[model samples]
Target: MLTSDTDAYYSPGHVAQVVAQTVERSRLKSVIDSHCGRGALLDAVEKSFPKIHCAGIDLDGNAISHLRKIRPHWTLVRGDSLAWTAWERIHRKLGGSVDVAVLNPPFSMGQVKGVNIELEGRVLRGSLAMAHVITTIYHSNPTRVVAVLPESTMFSEMDRQGRAELERLYDVEVVAQFKSSTFRGARANSLLVGMTRRKRQRAASSVEKAHYMSLHNAIVRGGLPCFEAVSLRHGVPFVHSTDIKDLVRGEAKESLRTVRPFTRGIVNGHMILLPRVGVPNKANIGAWFTEDDVQLSDCVIALQYRSERIAHAAAVNLRRDYEALASLYRGTGARYVTVGRLSEWLTNARNTRTYAQL
Candidate 1:
C-alpha cells in the first residue's frame, strides 16, 4: 500500500531487487540516485552495502523531505539534474569521481513541453539538455550508469541519431528490458541500460562485436544457406531491378532495331546484343547501331553461367566454384553478376511469364 506522486513508481521490493542487481554487477563504491523518488533506491543500496556511500537528488522538495525523514543518514539534495554547474559543484564536493549513478529520471517525453533554451550560450531543446548533462557526467567521470529509459527511446527509429550519440559516448548495453503499465496509468515499456566509460579503441571493438553477433544470429535464425555461392565485382554499372523486366519483355524499343554484332555481353541475368560501337545522337532514339557509331571499351563485360551441367568425361570442363568461374572468364572480357541482381532478373522473368499466361 505504498503511494507516491511520481510519474512512475516501482514497488519497494522491485526497486530493492534492481538496486541489488546493479550493485552486484558494477564496481560501485559510491552511488548517486538522480530523480530519487522516496529514497527507496537509496534504502536498498544502503541495506545491501552499509559501507557504500549513497546520495539522492530530486527536484521535488516534498520527495526530498520525505526521504530525509525516513533516511536521515542519506544525503538528499534538491536540484535540477540538467543544471551542469550545480551538478559539477556537487561532484566536486563529493571529493572524487563517483563509481555508479542509478536513475529513474522523470519520463518527460509527453508530459513536458520541450522548449528551445540557451545553455552556456548554446541553444538546445529541453530533452536534449537532459541528455547532454548525462553525457557530460559520463565524459567527465568514467562512472558506471544504469538508468531506466522509456521504451520508445530504446526502439524508436527516429531516435537513431540520439542512440548513436549515446552509444559513442558510453559503453552502452541494454542489460534487461520489459513492458509494464507503470506510468500515468498507461502500459509503457522500459529498458534498463548499463553503461561504463570505455576507451575509444575498446568501444570500437565492442560495437563491432555487437554488430557481428547480431548479424550471425539473424543469419542463423533465417535458415538461409550461406551466400558463399555468390561473388561480387565492385564498381559494376547497375541497372535497376525493374529495368530487367523491360529488357526481357522486348519492351525495350532499342532491342527492336537490327544492329550489327558489335559485341556480345551478359546483362540483367541474360545475354545482351550491343553494337561494337554505340549509336550517337540516337541516344534519344532508343535503337541499336553499327560499331562505327560507337567506341569499344572494357566497360561492359559478358556474364556467363552454365545453362547445363558439364560432365568431366565430356570435352566441356565442369566449374563448380564462383571464383573459378570468374577467373575463367576474366581474360574473355566478361564480368560477374551479383546474386541479388540475378534474383531480381528471375523474379521479373516469372512476372513476365505470368502476365503472358494471363
Candidate 2:
C-alpha cells in the first residue's frame, strides 16, 4: 500500500522474493529502502535476515510514522530522495554505506537540478525519478543494489543516457523480465535488476570476460532514425533486409530511394545492417559489403564496427550463434532486438576474435 500519484505501482510479492533472494546471496549486513511505501520491502527483508540492521525512507510522513510504530528500532526517515542533502544526513546518521540497497522508487520525469552524483567514471543525468534513485544509491556506495523498474527502463528513449551511464559503471548481474500483469493492477511490464558495485575495467583474461562486460560493449553506435518517407523522385539508395538478401545472392541492386536530408547517413559496408526486430534468421541477419553507401530505415540499425576483420567475423559468428543472439531480445513486441541486446552479441564476437588472435 505505497502512496504516490496515479502512476505509482507498489512491489508485487514475486518482486519482493527476487530482492530477498539477492539479499540472501550477497549476505548483506544492512539494508535500506529509498522509497519504502508501507514498508512492504523492509518487512520482506527483515523476515529473511531477522537480525540485520534496516532503515526506510519515504516522502509520506504517515507511511513513515506507521512503519516506525511497528519497527521503532529501525531508522525510518521522511525526505525527498532526489535531494542530495537528505542522503548526506542519512549517510552521517548510518555512519557508513549500507551493505545492500533495495529500491522501488517513483516512476516519473522531472528535471533534478544542481545534484551531481559521481559514479565510477561519469555522472548519470536525467530528470526522472528512476535516475535520481539510481544516482542516490550509487552515491551511498553500497556493495549491492536491487531495484524493480519498468521494462522500458531496459532501453527506453527517456532513460538512454542514464542507462548508458549505469552500464558503464556497474555490473548488471541480472535482468529478469516479467509481464505487467504480474502486478495485481498494473498494465506495463517491469524488470527486476541485480547490480553490484565494482571498479570499471576490462577483463584480464578470457575467463573473466563475463564478469567484466556483457555483449553490449561491442556496439559502437546504433539507433533507428526517424524521417519522412518520400517517392523515388526525391529518393537516394535505401537498404532493407530483403535488399541485403538480393545482394548476397548476386542479384542486381534493387532500386530503392529515400528522401533528402535523411536522418542517418549511408553506413559503410564494413558495418552490419540488422533488422531491429525479427525471428533471428539468416535472412533477417543483414550483413552488407557494398561498394557504395546507403541510408537505412527506422526498422533497422547500423552496428558500427571499428575494424573490417571484426565486422566480417561478427557476421559469420552471428549466423552460427543465432540461438544465443535470439535470447537478447528485450520486449515481447515483434521480437525487437534492442541496442543493448545487439551490443551483447557483438561483444562476444570481439572477445572470441581477440582470444583467437592471442
Candidate 3:
C-alpha cells in the first residue's frame, strides 16, 4: 500500500532534486522545511549542499519519528509549523539566520484539525493551510522563500487576499505555473513561487498594482427562458452568444422576438453573457452588454456586473481582444468556454486594466 498517514505526499526523488538544484544557486547557510514529510526534500538538500544546516517541521508524529531515526543529525521537530513557538525554536537553533525556507503545505482549507497557528504576532485566522504556511515562514523573514501552491491561489478571491497579505510582507519574484499533472491526484494546477522580503519603500505611483479582480469574485447566475417566458410580445430583447461579436461591431440585427417583461433569463443593461456552450470556429467567447434589458436562451451564461459602465467597458475591450478571448474555448467537437476558468483568465487580461488604473 503506497499510503502515508500525513497529508504529506512524499515528493518524487527527482522533484526533490530539482528543488535542491534550484536552491543551490543562492548563497545560504541554513534551510528550513516547514512541512518536511519523510525528509524527501532535506535528503536532496543535504546531498547537494552538505555543509548547509537543515531543520524540518511537521505536524505528523509518525513522520517526525521516522525522519528523526533515519536522519538523527537534523533538527527535526514535531509541531504545527505555523505556530509562533515552532518558528521561534527553529530560528534560535539555526542561529537566527533562516536563509531559505522550502514549503509544500497541505492543500487544504479550514483550520488543520482545529489547530490555530500564531501568525504576525497573533493567532492566524482562516483554514487556508497554504496561506498559513507562507505567512508563518515569511514572517520569520527568511532571505528567500520557495512554495508550491494551487494555481487558483493566483486568481481566486480568497487566495488573492492571502497573496495580498504576503506582498505586504515580501516581494514576489516568480510565479511559475504548471499543469495539474505535475502533482499526482492533484485536481487543480499548481504554482511554484519564489519570493523575498521587500527591502525598501517606493513612491505610491511606482508600485506595481495587484491584478484587477472585477471578475475574480464575480457571481455567475444564469437562466434559460421557458417557451412561455420567451414570446414575440412587447417585453425584453432576446440575445445569444453567437450575436456577441456582431453586437460589439455594431452589425447585429434586431432581435426578432421578445421575452416576458420579467422573464427568468431577463438581465438588465448591466450584464455580460457567453454561451453556456460554444462550437468550434465560432466567436462565442466574448462578453456582451447593451443599454436595453434582454433575456437569453438556456444556452447562454449571464454575468451581472455591478454597473452598466463596467459591463460596456468589458465588452468593448473583450471585442478588441477577441483572439485572446477565443483561445479560452475548451472541448473537442462541441466546445465551450468554462465559466470558472474564463473568470480566472479574465482577471489577468489587459481588458480589465480599468480596475487596475482605479
TM-scores of the candidates in the order shown: 0.49, 0.62, 0.60
Between prediction 1 and prediction 3, which has the larger TM-score? Answer: 3
Which residue pairs in candidate 3 have backbone atoms (N, alpha carbon, C) closer than 3 angstroms, thus clashing?
A: 110-127
lDDT of each residue in 1-358, candidate 1, tens digit only: 0113345464346745675576554345677776677776667777777777777777778988987887887766777655655466557656546776776666545544343334344553344324533544542363667677654444332233344445555667666654455443645556677777666623645654443222110100011112211222322222222233343344543332222222212122112221121211111112111212211122322222212111111112211222332332222233333322222232233422321111
Model 3: per-residue lDDT, tens digit, 1-358? 0123345556667667767766644456778888898888878888888887789988888999998898888998888765667767776777665777777777755333223344546653333554555655654567667776665454443343355556655666444555556666555556677777667633323332332223323434344444445475676676655656565455543643566654235554445566667742334433455656666666666655555566666656656666776788777777777655665566454534742222
* Candidate 1 colliding pairs: 262-276, 277-291, 277-294, 278-294
Q: What is the lDDT of residue 59 in candidate 2?
A: 79
lDDT score at residue 245, model 3, on the 0-100 scale: 56
- lDDT string for model 2 (1-358, tens) is 2223523467777678777877644355678888887877777888888877788777788888988898888877888766666677678778668877887777543333323444567674443555655766665767777877765455343454455555544666545666657666666556678877667543335323342223222332223244454545555566654555565455554455554435343454455666666654675453455556566666666654445565566667667767776777657567777665554344344544632221
Look at candidate 2 and tell me the lDDT of residue 260.
47
Note the Cα lDDT for every prediction shown: 0.44, 0.60, 0.60
* Model 2, global lDDT: 0.60
Candidate 3: what lDDT? 0.60
Give residue 142's lDDT in candidate 3 (0 to 100).
73
Task: Point out the higher-scoring one by lDDT: 1 or 3.
Answer: 3
